[model samples]
Target chain A: MKFGIGMFGDSGYDTKTNRFRDPEKRLKEIVEEVIQADTLGIDLFAMGEHHREDYVVSSPETMLAALSTVTKNIILSSGVNVISSADPVKLFQDYAMIDLLSGQRAEIMAGRGSFIESFPLFGQNLNDYNELFAEKLNLLLRLNKEEKINWKGTFRAPLKDQTIFPRPKREIPVWIAVGGTPTSVLRAAQLGLPIMFAIIGGNPRQFLPLVDYYKEQYALAGHAKDKMEIGVHAHTYIGDSRQAVLKAYYPAYSFQMNRIGKERGWSGSFTQSQFEAGMSMQGALYMGSAEEVTEKLINTIELFGLTRYIAHI
Target chain B: MKFGIGMFGDSGYDTKTNRFRDPEKRLKEIVEEVIQADTLGIDLFAMGEHHREDYVVSSPETMLAALSTVTKNIILSSGVNVISSADPVKLFQDYAMIDLLSGQRAEIMAGRGSFIESFPLFGQNLNDYNELFAEKLNLLLRLNKEEKINWKGTFRAPLKDQTIFPRPKREIPVWIAVGGTPTSVLRAAQLGLPIMFAIIGGNPRQFLPLVDYYKEQYALAGHAKDKMEIGVHAHTYIGDSRQAVLKAYYPAYSFQMNRIGKERGWSGSFTQSQFEAGMSMQGALYMGSAEEVTEKLINTIELFGLTRYIAHI
Candidate 1:
């Protein structure tokens, strides 16, 4: 199976002093980490876009473009490019540039961003969020399908037989990143695009119907099965001992979950006990010793027929 | 004065049949050219933007981003980023990305663009061209000036107290590129921004008044004279000898000029006589042996007090 890792540049907090790594240092460290990942036979190293006070990267393509040089074989991708709040023409041009610089090792992961701050920041209304994404994705696909485009949409300016320059030498990979929305899954499947399921939480097995449904729809739609690959994205950690991994990751994971929960108004705290339960065999968390985590991954892949797996560390 | 060159792919013609270089080869050649410039003690190597079949680069940041990784000390710049047809927020992020990768060596040359093709391509009206540029320039300046912006404008979506991330460690230089527009020069001077003038045709002495007016206005506007830099961008070629450079560059320049002139409906055949005359001491073009061109540049600098000279070779 193809393996990848997401470099989120997740702010590290000292369980001892409650301090976070400096943003600049965190960004530079991330560059080093991705360069290291390239030497480890990793197939892909994607950077996710998050516009927040806690996160460092707001533009994933920028980070990926920076990593294009030091990297040898690892495919550089935007874990998600938040297409809902972006100008797709410009976005396409940036990725095309990355493709040229990286010797065609560029990929785009389009998603309706988890954080809604970009909607207002880019002067997009939340009511038209999905519509914006659908329209932009359509335009982006048209750009990919051909050099010149004649497209009209409600959100963005219409293109009239316009061609984006610095076009890629090859058709770069375009994956649809979704978070358990059946409509999103069906859309990707109907369009014959690869689906990247973000199983960050909840019972991972509960999403079986969605992946199976996607495959059936993809096949029914008559896309080549050999060319299709479904991927799963999970938060994972591997330590020498299960207990050590649990102890080290629990506090940091709890801090992050609490922060996200607070932002989303979840009304409940994610305690260490909940974390322990999530680390169980059927749990969404992949926190454990290498052997245990690897066993769980094998089972999950067999269960879902996943061809690609991305673990965010 | 600082010396820089525009790494224009120049689309080499088949000297025998007058066929242009393929776009891919043109782009690859540009990368090598810029790398050569860096090792040759050049202070800056910039790439200009063009949206046409004959031109390879439409997004300068894309090219600059790629060059940032290979070069050591040479500054990477968009010789002109057609800001009039671009979104300032996206433009800021791309250039900021370049700056971070290049170790604070990113510069942006903002221009209204010599070619009008982008206006319709980007869904902008020709009638509102200058107004669109003015509005976008204001937004770009505001983004450059502050981290958190509460900006409103007619051309673009309004931002309500939002921050543009990955702000450059040091302020990246932004120069106003103009083609003999007195009003544009006055605007740049009023804003205390450097002016990059295009002296492509006619007698170069004709612009002495404009440059003098800019300096007077710049001083009157309370900007330090020492901090002020006015640049001249001219067509230049330095070869083994005057005859060799002329014979080599004339055919290609003629092909390009005829192509552009045809597009703009300017019926003018630039014959060898006119080309030779244009290379005279008082003429705008800077072509000949290195010694002759260097002497001309020295004399021109003494005459206009130019702080930067960019040759589009």
Candidate 2:
């Protein structure tokens, strides 16, 4: 099974000064941390795409392209493509460029991004979210496979004999990031694409049934079971002890969860018990020492027979 | 004055081996080369965005993001942005992300790309190129200045009080890449933007007059002369001997020029004399040792009073 690390590119807060240092310096530090992770036998390094203050990465492809030069073996992937709001042609061209720069190490996970801010910022409609994703995803899939494509969609202009250049060394690997959406899972299966489960909260094993559903649906769609790669994404940290891990991660984690929870209408304070539960739960939060992380990952890998494991380390 | 190195991220052709290595390896090498150049006092390391196989960089932002981690103290800039075909919001967001990744080293040069392939591929109209660039550029400029903006245009939907997030550490510097168009020059002046002259194959001094034109226009437009920095972009290389440099660069240069020339109806069987002329000609190719290149750059700097010099190394 392949293992990957994800970065939100968060700069740790300096409580003493109570002010963030230069963001560029913080960003460079975050990238170097990822590079360090890449050297530690990590198979992939995925960066989240966010248009928020806390999260630094808005162009994951650009970060991946830069990472392509620094690391030797890690496959550079984008955590989300924001398909509903982004132009498919530009995404294809950008990732293809990433493939060219990285020697085919570029992989993209497409979904309707979790953040709604991108919609208005990009002059897109939240009302057409489903339709926009459907149309754009179809076009993106078509562009990924064909060198020259003729595609017309409501969201964008039509292409007549249009060829997107600088094709990948081979077909770029694409995954559909589904956040507990059965229809999205089915769509991915129907399209013969891999599914990346965004299991940010709850137990990891809770997703087993969904994994089963994907496999059955994929098999029903005539795709071999072995051909499908079941993957999971979750927040993580590694430290000397459980206390150390929580001490390092809790404030940021609580801040993010609370901020997102407020927006999503979830009311709950992040507690120590929940953090402990999440760490020890039969799920994919690989947070602990190297051994602890390895143990948790091995268990999850064994449980799901996962082909890829992505952790926000 | 600042000096920058640009790489095409060229993918090599193999005649003997039918199998080919991907450009990712070459890109890694190029990053190392840029780091070396940075150590050697190169001010900026820029990569162009191209979608053709002959050129490898599909997303210069991604490459720059990776470079952000590995190198120190070098400005990371995109060689050009295809403003006419790209979504400006995404463009700004991506560059903002690069800024976060590279510690405010990110800068972009916006242009109406030399190639027309991006138009059809992105489902945009070739006829509406001017309007598209105008609207997008206007939006981008607004986005750059404000955290939240209300924008509406013909090309895309309306944005109602939207703010792009992950704001840069500082104001992201942008330059207009103009190919000697009077209107383009005026646009830069009126917008109070810096202008980069894409002088590929002409007398450098000829553009000196255009530089004067820009200065006069900027003053006429009620802008300070120092607010607008004039830069020159030209192909370059440094090798052991003139003969060696010519032999190495000619084949690739001829192949690229002729490919574009065919579409544009320019005739040329590049010869040794023309190559020599380009080397000797003021404001032409920069092919020589470090001292040779430095001398040539100093001459151009003195002759044109250029504030920035971008070498397509």
Candidate 3:
């Protein structure tokens, strides 16, 4: 199984200042973490885009470009590029540069980002979020396939058969990252794109229907079953013991979630019951000992036959 | 004086096939070339942006990002980011990323590009050429100063106290590149931006008036002479002998210049007399042996009191 790590560049809450620490220092830690992961034989590493003050990475490709230099072998990508707020041509150029630097180890995971801050930040309308994402994804995919693009779209300027320069030596894999929505799964499958199912909460088994639907859609879309791919991303952290892992991760996790919760109008308060349940067998969280995590991974792989598994910490 | 090398990432024309080479291969050569330049103790290295097929880079920051990994100690910069055709926020993000990756070895040379192809490629109009550049440059300067900007402009969407993330750790020096234009020089001087004068053609003495005008304007604008800076970029090639250098670079240089010349209604043909004249003392082109080149650079530096000298090969 392909295994990887994901970072959001979030400086976990500082108790003294009661705010995140310097993002620059946190970004440095990420570079060190990636170097360590590469040495440890990790298959890939991805970073997510977040626009709020809590997250340092508003541009994932920027972080990837930094990581591309210090890490070797580990495929570099955006856990999700938050393509909904970005221009596809620019995204292609940025990641293509990373691919070249990493010797073709770059991939782009496009998503209608979980966060909405980028919408207003880039002067995008919240009403058009879904449409904006679909349109941009279409544009992003077309760019990877063709260098000289002649296209018109509503949300972005037209490409008048203009060529995008410095194309990568190999085609970059552009994956679609999806949540619990069947429509998102079906859309990815229909496009013959790989899907990275983000199961950050609840039971992993609950996503079985969406996975099954995606495969069915893949077949209907005439994609070869052998070539189709599925990846899993979850809230994960490993420690010597289950209690130790929870103790170390919960405070920060609760802080971040509550911080995000304030913005989205949801109660981000954490309870021990929810945490314990999420860490149990078949649960969404991967917080546990090596054996417990391994067994959980095995069970999930057997359930969905995942091609790749990524844990976010 | 700060001495550096400049690469345009131009694909040399193939005599047999009569076509430019693969840009991917050319880009790889650029990487190796920068590594060698770094080892040779070059102080800075700059890459130019072009949208046409003959040139590989449309995004200089992308190339700089790739180079940031393989080389050290060289200050990375764009020969000029065609700010007229770019989003200033995006340009800031890309270069900031480069700065982070390179540990503060990053700069930006902003220019109303000598070539106009990018203006059209990025959905801009030639009619608004000067205005577009000035407006975008104002925004770019604002970005460098403030983390959260409330900027409103004609060409771009309004930024309502929006934050541009991943600001560089240190101040990123932004230099203005000019091609002997009185207005451009005066603007650079008035804005207190350093100037990178491109002396690609004609007698070097011809630019003296414009340079002097800049200094007078800079003083009137209240910028201290000691604090102000200037740089020069010229067509250059080095070899064992002047004869070898000319014969080696002439074919490709003429082809590119003429190709560009044809579009601008000028005769692209080169004669031995003009070539010889251009390589002499007080000439523009810097094609010669180590001693000859050094003498030329020293003469020019003495003539203009140049702070930096970059040779475009």
Candidate 4:
């Protein structure tokens, strides 16, 4: 099984200043972090996009390109590229260049982002959210496969025999990232693409039905069963002891959860009970000592028949 | 005076296969070259954008981002980001991230690119070329200065109280690159922006009048004289001896010139006499022994009182 690490590059909260830490310092730390991960033989590193003061990176591809020259062996990917609000032509070309720079170690994980800031920021309308993703994803897939393309789409300017340059040595890997959406799962299955489920809260086993559905639909769609790949991404933190990790991770974790929950109008603050429950064997949060986390990971891997597991730290 | 080097990252012609050299090899070589330049204490390195098979880099910012981590001291910049067809918001954010990554060493040299490939590739109309550059430049400058912006333009969606994130540590230097266009020079002067003249062809002294015009206009516009900056970018090659350089560089140089000449419908083949003239003191080409090129560079710098000179090799 493939194991990977993921980061949103959040600017750390500094209680002394009562504000976010400097993004530059955080970005430098991320470079060092990835280099260390590569040295430790991590399988992949996925960076997520966030256009905000709290996050250091808005362009995952840029961060990936920066790491391409410094690291070896680890796959560089966007955790979710927010393709709905992105220009696919530009996105494909950028990643294509990264692929060449990294010796074919680049992948793209496409998702309708969990955040809405990118919509108006990139001049995309919220009303066309679903349609925008579907259309742009179609364009992105076509750009990967075709040399010269003649295409028409509602959201973007029409292409009349256009070709993107610096083609990849091989077709770059494209994975679908879903958040408990069956239609999204059906789409990936129908297209025979690998799927990554974001199981950030609640019991990890709850996603088994969706995983089973994906497998059934994938087989019914005439895709090879052995070729199907399934993966899960969850909030994770590890330390020498459960108490030590909790002491180090809980304050920041709860603060972030409450901050986002407040933004989304979710009821109540994040409590110790919720955190404790999430740290359990069936829980989604992959936290605790190395031995405990390893056992949980093995169980989850077997439960989902996962080909990949990403610890979102 | 500040000195810099520039490259278009041309995939060299392979005489044996009669094909372009592999771009992957060229890209890796570029990273090594920049590292060497940085080690040698070059003031800056500028990478140009090209959307074609012969050039390896289509995104200059990507290349700059890659170099930012590996190199120290050398300023990383887009030699001439084709900003006319580019999204200014995206451009600013990308460079802002690069600036933070490099401790404020990132810069942008904006230009309406010499080639037209990006126009159609990015779905921009050639008729709106000049206007597009004007509008985008205005937006880019504002993004550098303002924390909150409200802007409306013909080519892009209006920004309503928008604030781009991951702000730069300082106003990232913005320079205008002109191909001997008086109005373009006047605009840069009027805006109090540094201007870079691309003196790639003809006698180098021929640009004296235009340089004088810029100095006059810059003063007339009431910008600080001491703060004024002017730079020149020229086609350059340096070697141990003229004969050694000629023997090695002539075939490939003539091939590229003839190939582009064919595309632009320019008459006649590139001849040896023309190459010899270009290598002379009066020529724009900076090809010769290190002493000869240094003397020529000093002369050109004094002739225009250049604050900076970029050898586009």
Top-lDDT structure, candidate number? 4
Model 3 regions more than 4 Å off: A17-19
True contacts kept of 2: 0.84
RMSD of 3: 1.9
lDDT score of model 2?
0.79
**Which digits, one per residue and each the tens of the lDDT, describe model 1 over residues B118-231?**
787678888988999999999999888898899889988899888866666667789999899998999999999999888998888889999999999999999998999999
lDDT of 3 by residue, B165-265 (tens): 66677768999999988999999999999999999888887888888888899999999889888889998877788898788876777667777778888
Pick out the ten consecutive residues of candidate 3 chain A with the lowest summed lDDT.
A19-28
What lDDT tens digits, residue by residue, belong to model 1 across residues A1-313? 8899985667576657776655656776888888889999999987888766667777888787777766889999888889999988878877887787677899999999888878876779999988988999998898998887889889877998898765777777889999998989988998999989999887889889999999999999999999778999998899888799877878778888998899899999998778877788878988799898898899899999999999988
Q: Could you tell me the lDDT of residue B281 within candidate 2?
A: 46
* Native-structure RMSD, model 2: 3.5
lDDT of 3 at A79: 88
CA lDDT of each prediction against the hidden true structure: 0.84, 0.79, 0.84, 0.91
Please give the lDDT score at residue A239 for candidate 4. 95
Candidate ordering by DockQ (highest first) = 4, 2, 3, 1
TM-score, one value per model:
0.95, 0.88, 0.96, 0.98
Stretches of candidate 1 exceeding 4 Å from the true structure: A11-23, B10-22
Model 2, A65-131: lDDT tens per residue?
7677777778888888787887788888778867766667889888888876678777677889889
TM-score for model 2?
0.88
Q: Write the per-residue lDDT of candidate 3 for residues A1-313, one digit (tens) a residue.
A: 7998987877566889776676667776787889899999999998988776677777788778767766779999898888888888878877777787677889999889887777876678989988999999998888889878888888888888776766777789999999998889989999999999999888999999999999999999999999899999998888899999878887777766676678778864766777889999957998899999989998898899899999888
